[model samples]
Target: MTEFDEILKLEIEARKKIEQAEKKAERIKQEGIKQAEEVLSQVQKEVEDYRKEKQIELEENIANLKQELETNFKLRVEKIRGVFEHNKERLKSIIYSVLGFN
Candidate 1:
């Protein structure tokens, strides 16, 4: 065969190799994109779960605070009622003195 024919054959073979490399690169790119999408989906699910957990925790804390407030208010009201009963006689005497209702 002539040198020119040999060179032409080499050029064609090189072109075929380059095409195969491009196809392989395209396949790898698609695979990478699919993997990234899967990871993103998983991360989104994890974030949703974390949000639900935090919401439940917050609700529990709010309930606890409300119960504590109610308990404290009841205790304070009882103490005030006791003081009023203890001062009832003095309060009556003061009222009569002020209005001259003795």
Candidate 2:
């Protein structure tokens, strides 16, 4: 073959090799993107699960606090009632004397 024909054949082979390399690169890039998406999806799910767990824990804590506060309030009210009952007779006597009806 002439030098020109040999050069043309070499050029054609080079083009074919370049095309194959480009195809391989594109496949690798697509696989990388797919793997990254999967990782992102898994992370999102894990974050959601963690958030839900924290929320439930917070709710339980709030419920316990509310219950404790209610119990304390009831105890305070009972103490106030006891105090008033113990002083009710004295209060009545004082009122009667103040009105000049002693």
Candidate 3:
């Protein structure tokens, strides 16, 4: 073959290799993008689940606190009742003694 024909054949082969390499690189880039999107989706789902769990825990804690407050109020009311009853008896005895009714 002439030198010109040989040169032309080599140029064609080089262009074919370059095209194949470009296609392979494009496929690798697409795959990387797909994997990154999947990871981001998983992380977002996990964050949402964590938020829901914490919200439930906070609600339960609030309910427990309200129950404790109600119990404390009831105990305080009973103590106040006892004190008032004792005061009434003491007042009655003092009045009887002062008026000579003892």
Cα TM-score per model: 0.81, 0.83, 0.82
Against the true structure, candidate 3 has what lDDT?
Answer: 0.98
Shift of residue 47 alpha carbon in model 1, Å: 1.0
Q: What lDDT does candidate 3 reach at residue 81?
A: 95
lDDT value, candidate 1, whole model? 0.98
TM-score of 2: 0.83
Name the lDDT value of residue 32 in candidate 2.
Answer: 100
lDDT tens per residue, model 3, 15-92 = 999999999999999999999999999999999999999999999999999999999999999999999989989999
Superposed by TM-score, candidate 2 places the C-alpha of residue 24 at a distance from the truth, in angstroms, of 0.9
| Candidate 2 lDDT over residue span 2-56, tens digit each | 9999999999999999999999999999999999999999999999999999999
Regions of candidate 3 where Cα sits further than 4 Å from its true position: none
Model 3 lDDT-worst window of ten: 82-91
lDDT of each: 0.98, 0.98, 0.98
Better of 1 and 2 by TM-score: 2
- Residues 48-73, candidate 1, lDDT per residue (tens digit)? 99999999999999999999999999
